[model samples]
Target: MYRIAFGTSGWRGILCEDFTFENVKVVTQAIADHVTAIGERDKGLIVAYDTRFMGERFAKETARVLAGSGIKAYFCKRDTPTPVVSFEILRRGAAGAINFTASHNPPEYNGIKFSPSWGGPALPETTGDIERRANEMLGEVCYRELALDEAARSGLLEEIDPRRTYLAELEKKVDFAAIAGLGTVAVNALYGTGRGYLDEPLTAHKVSVRTMNMHRDPYFGGFPPEPSEKYIQDFINLVKGDPAIRLGIATDGDADRFGIIDEDGTFIEPNYIIALLLDYLVRVRKMTGAVARSVATSHLVDAVARKHGIEVIETPVGFKYIGELISQDRIIIGGEESAGLTIKGHVPEKDGILACFLVAEMVAREGMSVKRLLERLYGEVGTFVTKRENITLSPELEAGYAAKQHQAPGEFAGLKVRETVTVDGSKFILEDGSWLLFRKSGTEPVVRLYGEASSAERLAAVMAAGKAFILG
Candidate 1:
């Protein structure tokens, strides 16, 4: 039971392991208690689930727990995207929400994500309290539960479909008019909850869309429902083979992270996408504001901000930090290298559907291919390349890192260390404007090495040096 710890996102664990129904009930009760303590129990909660196995059941159980606690549960009727759930939280002015999703994790895994009334991931302070209370109640099994019908009869459970309202909100955020002019787009939902949320909007806007893997699949087609390059190859191939398809977009299991493929079948890295969109938002849309990014993200965004004379807020690794900026209207856009992003005047939570639609709008309004647009941005802001790799840690290495004994070198990859930023990890900024960051994973015996340089070759060299430094 103590193994049910929260990570950067939430308390995720393998099904039938730490993520059992008993643990879910315990965590749900903890959340209910926390909400009640805050005097928001009357506001009710929006409960949703993704396409993972038993996600609906887990969500229903969560609602039962909330109902048993004398709180109302506004439950989603079908698998709902994370962003949609977040929007519903704000729309209904609910106390908060409990979402059953593991995001991009493998199918064997499922977890609960709790968002506060602000419609963003719960911050550390809130999650920490819930974690402590849940662990304290490990073997208690003292929770109230009500049947679905009874909860509804008692006016504690209300079924809802957030799609219509969520899509209406999205229309105001994305430039659907521009996207309607775009000839064709391909969407790969990865058998997650993004099918209707991402693909339907484009079709509704009169954009010709071809969708793949839109059906619900508990196995996620035998691959983790991550919208990264490795997992989205078939979608890339589909777009590449079709001459009419102008772009390829995809979302993870819960539709909060995005993956993009250019018209030429290039898998544009999320770092590049963030930079490109920052430039687009600033230069094209004339949206005036600073930007925020995680420390592990690329400095290309900084280059764009510098070019535009806009401020850049550097945050820790989690989107929660970035989301904080969005909530405060401090940034025009907030993004991470992990393909999560949300913009100002929107829910603070990451919205892959919105990200994908905005890219389409960029392509249409610019009247150029995504590759060309990227080249244009490079021509203006100069070129920047970034890479990341994970190195497995031995027991000794893990202990050394835990003790903070592993320090950045005076020089790396034949460059002098100009500065070091320790906001989230040891980010050594080299004299040549390159950087190497080493961050330890909370749940695994591995260190993530991030490198950014002026060119691909330099990025490779920096990554190699980072790997050598960590392994040594």
Candidate 2:
């Protein structure tokens, strides 16, 4: 029997392998039990999925399990975005939400993401309880499930479409009036759940927009449904080839992560986007609050907070920590370097649809390309370059990785170390304001190295030195 382990997000495994139907039922039952224990079973739970193969089937199965456990299930009529699911959780005051999505992972992969009543990713405590229950019931017919039709007849299930209400919420949060006059904008759904959410609002506002990959394909056009720079070169080419295209925006499989392309065909890094948006929200929108970012994120956010006379809260690698602050109304924005972010007034979940719209509104109001806006921000608060690399470790190095991170060097790359931070990883803040972080994976023979500096040249040197230090 496979141990049902939940990672930073949720339990993910390849289809027909560890993520079989039997396993999903076990996990759903575990969740149902958890809800009962928490005394929130009467509030009902939302069931949603993305555009992956067997998505709706998996959703129905999950709902059946919930119904069998005597919990009402709110079923989405179509494939839904992760953020939209979060919105529904809060909108209906549901007990929680069970989303069947692998996020940006490959097509062959599928998983479950659970959000509690707070409408953010479940913390370790919740997932730990579910995991323990699931593993205990493995390999036994330990779960009961109600058929979809039977559940509906008994009022244990209700179908819903969240698109209209979700878009309406966007109109209130985003300045659609500003984006109306912007020139033609390009959108790439990447064959995921972002098709209507990202493009519909712009179209409804009378903004000229062109969209690609609107049709759903389980294969995701032969690539992982991620909007990263390397994975979205076709979108970059589209923006580069057309002078009429003012900007390009994209979202991942579940519409929880965003990617941006400048008018001149430059792919803006998410790190820089976070910092730029942070500054824009403080200066233009007049929003007042501190900001939150992952420890692996760029410190340029710190510079922006400094300029605005606000605080910067750094959390561990997961977005859940940042989401907690958002729930508490402690930050104007919270972001991860992995392209996830949410605002203070929004649901405590990453909203790629919201992120793209914010970028468009910023461009419209500023009357400048994203590149120019970045250059302008760079001038205001010194420049920063950030990079992340994964280094495969040999058996010997892997065995000693833990020991290496604990022993921090006083000097690295010929620069004096100013501070050593061990929040999520071992980060050495150099005297020159540059920094390096080393985090080794517990399940894999690899280490993730993150580096940031004031210049590209310095970043390159720091990355190399970090790799060397890890190997040695």
Index of the highest-TM-score prediction: 2
How far is each candidate from the true structure, as Cα RMSD in Å? 1.1, 0.8
Q: Rate the local accuracy (lDDT) of all candidates.
A: 0.91, 0.93
lDDT for model 2, on a 0 to 1 scale? 0.93
User: 128-206 in candidate 1: lDDT tens per residue?
Assistant: 9899888888888877899989999999999999999999998888889899898889999999999888888888888
Off by more than 4 A, model 1: 403-406
lDDT per residue, candidate 2, 1-472, as tens digits? Answer: 5799988888999999999999999999999999999999999999999999999999999999999998999999999999999999999999999999999999999999999999999999999999999999999989999998999999999999999999999989999999998889999999999988988889888988988888899999999999998888889998999999999999999999999999988999999999999999999989999999999999999999999999999999988899899999999999999999999899899999999999999999999999999999999999999999999999999988888877767877788999988889799999999999998876589999999999999889888889998998
Pick by lDDT: which candidate is best?
2
TM, every model = 0.98, 0.99
CA shift of 95, model 2, Å: 0.5
Q: Which pairs clash in the backbone of model 1?
A: none
Stretch of 10 with least lDDT, candidate 2:
404-413
Question: Candidate 2 deviates by what RMSD?
Answer: 0.8
Task: Give model 2's TM-score versus the native structure.
Answer: 0.99
